[model samples]
Target: KFTITDGRIARIETDTSAGDAVRLGPALPGLANVQSHAFQGAMAGLAETRGDTGDTFWTWREVMYRFLERLDPDMAQAIAAMGQVEMLEGGFTRVGEFH
Candidate 1:
């Protein structure tokens, strides 16, 4: 909880009875995934395979590019939303998506 005064932060307090407080319910403290390729989150299960030459970074890149080719702006937005939701559920409140 907090008591603001004249548009500046004033008394800061933790209140058990705060009406709008979000209860974490045994969850760990939120963490940040500092290097997230959030777009990959959407294509997670689809790219966990090896190519004929065996998997490499180049192979993964190709798969990611293919995923992008089929993704329009709206689809990308939805996918990003899904990633954000997953991150939050996994106790990550902040992320830096590389895509």
Candidate 2:
């Protein structure tokens, strides 16, 4: 069993003990969501279609830079928080955020 508190696992018990009641459930390991540019989460599916010329990571970067030009600290934080929430809901316990 895995006991989580404050976004971390508090304890792991494989066998029941006498002092307290033991609860059994699937134990999930934390996962690091690597390779995420949190800023890109806001643009998911926005640039998937082929561009007039062509599109690739380079083109995507151009779009990303334009997006970053408008980001102040507060906007950045909000975007990061939203990304983290999405990662957590998607079963990621840790995030290796690139941006």
Candidate 3:
């Protein structure tokens, strides 16, 4: 059993009766994203095209460089915020960002 206070887990114990406890189904620990380029999330689906060279990692690197050249601090923060929201919705409780 567990007790929540202020939207956080306050206590956890086993072999106790659940008295007036809310059942939220079987709970799984939230996952952590160990490696994330949050800024690159803003380019989702924008680099999937097959170029004349047939889409190599070099091509993608070039695209990313161009994107980064135009990204300012505010834009990076906004993209990171959006990525964080997406990560939470996707069941990530923590993130280790690469940028």
Highest-scoring model, TM-score: 3
Ranking by TM-score: 3, 2, 1
For all candidates in order, the CA lDDT equals 0.78, 0.79, 0.87
The residue pairs that clash in candidate 1, if any, are: none
After superposing candidate 1, which stretches have Cα over 4 Å from the reference? 1-28
User: For candidate 1, what is the TM-score?
Assistant: 0.65
Assess the local accuracy of residue 4 in candidate 2 as a C-alpha lDDT between 0 and 100: 68
What does each candidate score in C-alpha RMSD?
Answer: 6.6, 3.5, 1.8
* Per-residue lDDT over 27-78 for candidate 2, one digit per residue giving the tens place of the 0 to 100 score: 5677788877877888777677877787788998888788889889999999
What is the full ranking by lDDT, best candidate first?
3, 2, 1
Greater TM-score among 1 and 2 belongs to: 2
Residue 38 error for model 1, in Å? 1.1
On the 0 to 100 scale, the lDDT of residue 24 in model 3 is: 84
lDDT of 3 by residue, 1-99 (tens): 878789667888898888888898876678999997888888878798787877889889999999899999998889999999999999899999986
Off by over 4 Å in 2: 1-26
Off by over 4 Å in 3: none
The best candidate in terms of lDDT: 3
> Model 2 compared with the native: what TM-score?
0.69
Q: Please give each candidate's TM-score.
A: 0.65, 0.69, 0.82
